[model samples]
Target: MKLRCELLLACGLFLALVLIFWSEALPEDRTLFLRDLSAEIIPVRSFWVRSGGFALWNPYSFFGMPYSANPQNQAFYPFNLFYYFFGAERGLVFYIIFHHFLFVFTLYWALREMGFQREGSFLGAIGFSFGGFFCSLSMLVAVLSTLIWFPLIIIFLIRAGKSHWLKPGLGIGLLIALQVFAGEMEIAGISWLLSLFAILFLPEDIRGHLSVRRIFLALGLGIFFGAILSAFQWLITLEFIPLSNRASGFGLVDALLWSIEPFQLKSFVIPNYILPASRLSLSTSAFWGLGFFSEYSYFLSLYSGIIVLLLALFSMGGVRSWKIWFWVLLAGFALAMSMGNTLPVYKFFYFHIPFFNLFRFPSKFLFLFYFALMMLAVYGWQRIQHKPRRIFGFGVLIIGIGLLLYLIFSRLNLEDSSLGAELIAHKFFLRSSLRVLAFFCLGLGLIFLLGSNMRFWLSAGLGVLCFLDLFFAHRYLNPVIKRDFYRGNSYVQEFNNQKRSLVYPPRIASLSAPSEELSFQWLTDPIELYSRLRDGLENYWSTYFGIADLRAYSLFCLSEVSELGKLLAEDSLSPGVRRLALARSGVEYIYYRDYGFVNLSLSYPRALILYQAKIVKDREQIFRIFSDANFPGLRSVLIEAEDKVAGDKNFAPMSDFARVISYENEKVVIDAEARADGWLLLLDSYYPGWRAFVDGKEVRIYRANGFFRAVKIPAGRHRVIFNYFPESFTRGLLISGIGFFLWLFLFGISFKMGKGRK
Candidate 1:
């Protein structure tokens, strides 16, 4: 009953902190409304709309990307069934809240064996929950969701030492499946590996009670069955991994792309080194000299809290034993691994490890590093209350050290003079920095008032300190978004109405810039990140208006297509560049709207629709024509003697006067009236999944016009149809269904056999 009360009160406090931390989020104000939202969330939202039907292909993004193959979108995760009902914006908030709860719950459950008091348990849970990784990267829903399952599985692994097969085995398998289903495969993979490590390296005390052979058998089944349970998502990802854009493979340098930089190690002392400008307080400018964008420049802070750090360090101060050394080694390993190419150790792992070769972004391991710090904090607070000198002396030292950082960073010159206002308003950062350190100092100062028996205030003060620090960190950690960020141009409304009146395969393509949302690009540096989805969101808007789009932000940008985009970025490029990019994308009608918020313009691509296709020379000559400034426009498209060029105001150019019969994701029907045996070109992306049929007979679909689908039609008005039937998705689904039931059967048989023996 006491434990339950403590949990309820702790939950209330945690939720309040959540509300305060995310106070900026409001209706229609998308939280983290850029990269993660656009690339991962919105695309999944778009996928959800068509997935109920047989749409394995997304004809909107990047001239039609493979919807099912893009594993990051995470549409297939089970949590979506409940959360998605709230809509994307609200669903994200709910997900963040729910995962925070899970984080606390799992940590508390795992700590039960150590026999910490109620207050100690509560503090450990909150401290771990409020760690810098959680505060900074909570916006990444998949990572947050995937992370909570680690502790939960650890709790189950702790139970794995028991001789009974059902409890530990069922818990491990179910929790592992949940983690895998949470949609961050890389993180989930690490969690499973860690769980296996724990299972194999059972504590000596617990190992004594268990039969080694039985334990091994049960643990093996647990892992194997867990894989089967998540076979649905796993099988599809396995198929996608080799062919993904990363399939070109990651070189050592590429693996270090998001590695924690050497300078960023200062984040251990100075948090918020990578916060977005919007999250900065006015005082941040005074300390601005210390700031730098090493990599993504967001979601990398791992300073749990100053007081928390003091307590964690003190917890290990009294020990020089195996337990402490074990943590030191593990913590050092995580940090070194996060260093990527900066350390030779990571390079060795990249080449020697199988999954390590797949993805980059090494700094993501900070979450694990932060967990290690929390373990020390739990032990420190548990022991430090009895040691008064350590608390008082450590508190004073933290307070005094603020002057050193201030002196070092305050003298630096400004790169951007405009940022000086922040320093001026906040008294050149002196007042704010002292106040931040003072928060920790005050929590520490409260320690002197503690007597030997009054442990409650000491615990309560520390718990409140953790919350205060997290509130301070994340208040700016989360960017405040507004309606203006997403709400743009009346063009979407006009295009929405235009889409209803358009012919079959009503796919829209931008003729000039990738999107009208390019205005947001100027905020990011020579390279854009943490907000690359500005263009992706624009494409999502087109999909929201129920129109298929040609330009979409995709990770799987084909090399040829990526080069085309780069060529178009230069103002010196000809109008032919736009024509070539759009022509191959099956764009019949172009939407060209540009608002002069900046000098940026994407108002040219759609205008190419007016340039009728004419026969030109071969592929080599086409590139030559594009290079020449004096060369002609869309006329360059006519390459071969057999090449046919035709499209109308409505954009469907199946042959010449191709009337639309019907258009669906599964199939498209067109009535063509071609003169002689001219080829009928469908300006949709070419994928092996699509099959072509003419007048009810199967015909071959050829990759034509660089990246589009084209079919040869005999002269007549016979109907031509194209349908999507991706073999990979179908095969994966069948295997997953069989595997799921097979897991059920095996688990039931084992469970019954164990009961009979009992």
Candidate 2:
């Protein structure tokens, strides 16, 4: 009953903090939420809505494009789904609230285990829930949600610390399971490794409680859970190792250093006018320097340094034990070392240390340090209480005086600088002053915490602190916020609108296969498509660089299509003997509203000469269009519609078009009109050896482009013949067969080994 009460208080306090902070920052993102809302509405679950049909089954490319482009790999599956069921506007509101809940829940549990008073624990939960780390992560829906379950895992670890035997192993296993489910494996690996180190730092009595059997059991369970969790990724990896060699470190380094620069603190006092390169950078710097507690100059910004210094000074006093101080310092040192330019020999103690190289963004680990600082500040309050209950009143007065002076000076400086009174009045004083005042009140409440044992005051105080800190500090701390992180840039938003702007000038031309219009609706729910249609198209788009479509970015750049051949060959093609190229034409064609936002170019062989290429190429009255059937022989149509609407637009029903059935051993058929139209049948060199005829006349099959194994048919109805040579699909079939057998063999072996061990 007592534990349950404590939990309730913690939850209540956390909610209060979230409400306060959220009221200030909830609608901070205008564009991203709208984009996500738009995605939610897209019926054709496609990353790129080129032509909405099942004609090209390339779903892998859909998901892969986004993952490769952005590091925001944490999926917003639930949020996307939420919007699907609920209306977008209400769905997004629920998502924000839910994430807040998760953020607080994890913290409450972790803090409770750290020996904080229930109220203090609640406060800690609130603080972290609305902390810079949470806000920074929240910029991307996926990353934020992925991290929410992490603290819960850590809480279990703390619990396991109670008994190291069987429970700890089970705890470790549970952590692994949660991490797998969360889909933030790399970050989880780093956190788990840190947790293990922390476990080792426990007192000897606690350490002694652990045994080899327990450790082994925990490890075994972890492996078991990991296998179960990662089975799907493993299965796909059998096709080709899904290993990403791109170092996350440089991006991590850039993300880390970017926030710490002196300019961000100024922006905090000012407005979004002073933009930084990235949000992660800004938030990281805020955590390091102008944190909630101190005021000291860092590379010239005394605001952050001063805050950190004050907190550190407060921590100098001892509470019940010296271990807390030691742990805080240890955590700080770990963060500094990890961020610095040195080989992390200490990291090698874990099995996944080398694997950490895959993710270069080390700054993300600062979250652990941030957690430590919050606890340490509370520790400071706890420590001062030991001096005497009588001194509490005086201490509260002094703390209050100090806070007042800082705010006054900060406000004065803001007004005096070129930062401007109008801006300062609106952006800083009006927007941020209330949060600072609330935080000041929290410090006063902490004094009460020292004097009395009342759980309510402590909870209330902590809640206030969490609210003020997050609400006041995020603008300075998160670059994502400053750069309109969720809103997306100008062009991306434009792409989301269903109607294309004819700014340059042009008219929409109707085609035989009218292209699907890109809609404005996707602006609110871009990831909606990822949820509904699994096999149709890739969905989900974000400005966060690591997990969106690179093709999306290409909208800003223009390059010759032929130049792409070399890159595609190098990156995607197998060890072909030689001569990579693309066919001049295809069996299918695509049309676009304009160059519009789609800038990705198709590759074709140099051997194929361009007869004519025009921006608004037209067959008759159609504009800005492309076609598989040129001004020549064309017959027979097969349209696979990913969306039923696509069939309605482009494809004629089977009854409307002619169908060629296999007649004799010769597998040859032709449409009589093909010859007169002067449309020639062109085959790719990779195509199987074959002969062709039109209206009983022998025609040469010319190999033009290397990529397209195409047979051109004349305008009007024409018969087509295709004979599949045995060698064509041989390697593909062989590879697939071998892979299937090997998977079975491995499964059997693993099963037998497990049985034998048992």
Q: Write down the worst ten-residue block by lDDT for model 1.
A: 602-611
Write candidate 2's Cα lDDT for 1-758 as tens digits.
Answer: 48778677657756765565445335534222322333322221222222212111111221112221222322223344544454333344456667777767766776555555655555555555555556555443444555666666555555544444334444455446445534555566656665554445444455566443444455555545544444433332222222222322223344234223223334323222211212323222212221222221121111221122233346676443555756677666655534433434223422244444444344455556655665665555444443224356456646655765665565433224465434443543343444354355445536554454544554454455545455556533322122132343344345445333311111111111112223212111212222221111123332121112212221101121122324334443432211111112221112122322332233221111121112121212220112222411122212211222111123221112223333222242433233222223222222223456555544544322222223334445555553322232234335445544544565566456547756
Model 2, TM vs. native:
0.54
- For candidate 2, give the lDDT of residue 308: 24
lDDT of each: 0.58, 0.38
The true-versus-predicted C-alpha distance at residue 129 of model 1, in Å, is 1.9
Candidate 1 residue 52 Cα shift, in angstroms, is 5.6
Q: lDDT tens digits, residues 177-235, model 1?
A: 77676767778777766555444443356546655565555567667767766665666
Q: C-alpha displacement of 27 in model 1, angstroms?
A: 6.4
Number of clashes recorded per candidate: 9, 69
TM-score between candidate 1 and the true structure: 0.78
